[model samples]
Target: MKKMILSALMLAGLVSCQQDFNPGTNGSSLTVRSGTSFGMCVGYCRQEVVIDNKNTVFTKTSREADKNPPVTCEKQTDSGTWNEIATKVNFDAFQKIPETLGCPDCADGGAEYVEIQLNDSRHRVTFEYNKTIPGFEDLVTAVRQQRNAFADCK
Candidate 1:
């Protein structure tokens, strides 16, 4: 009875933390990536920039010739401050970027990405488009500001 109880508790613990586990791939050291919005829109968009704990950066790109297909890649870079670059990208425009990329694999209309940094060591982005959180008028304003910024910049 004692052994069975101990095993059950251990199993429950593992199941609870499943989403928090990181089985480091290749030779990249692992770190906890947290999602925080600088200026959120009605929705979020994927950053497509994979920044790990070590601050190495990567972009999500496609090179089709068969065989290789689409894969998560890491770009070698010098260490620096981590932040979300696509934060200022317009909500609609940003949404289009991924729909063209490879988001169809996981979603029907697809989803947007969110930009987040880990430990301030790596600057990476993510796609964590949640259902439009109500009463976030500030998000709507920021999205408009971003859209205008892009148009005015050119």
Candidate 2:
């Protein structure tokens, strides 16, 4: 009976440790991505930018792409450019934002989404277009500002 009880306690301890584990702080490589998506737009309705430790990519999706042409612009970002953008992002501030920023009364027709993958955790949030939390607006601006930098990359 003593051996059986000890085994059960050891198993329970292991399970508890596993439950507290988080992959995001494992010091692994990660990428942070943010973008805006709006439906029924004229051109380039959807734009998304993704930034990894040393690389970034900006993709533009137009309405015509749905047909046969599949219009899109994909740019490979330089490390320096991505690094500059990284400086602007505040992961702590981002994590503070609520999981979801919904504007039910805004009557907005579009939405914006932000996703951050650090180490082993992925945090994503969506808010109504033209509406955002206080500090979130700055974060979103920093994330979206990379568009021009990526466009100029050669």
Give the lDDT of residue 70 in candidate 2: 30
Runs in model 2 with CA error above 4 Å? 1-28, 62-81, 88-93, 104-108, 148-154
Full-model lDDT for every candidate: 0.33, 0.62
lDDT of 2 by residue, 25-123 (tens): 432355667767777667666667787655567776767866533333455556565555455455555677787788522443787778777656667
Which tens-of-lDDT digit does each residue in 49-136 have in candidate 1? Answer: 3334344332222233253333334433333222122222223232233322233225344343333222223322233333222332
**Per-prediction TM-score to the true structure, in the order listed:** 0.24, 0.59
Error of 1 at 105 (Å): 15
Leading candidate by TM-score: 2
- Give Cα distance to truth, residue 53, candidate 2, Å: 3.0
Clashing pairs in 1: 45-112, 45-113, 45-114, 46-112, 46-113, 113-127, 114-126
The top-ranked prediction according to lDDT is: 2
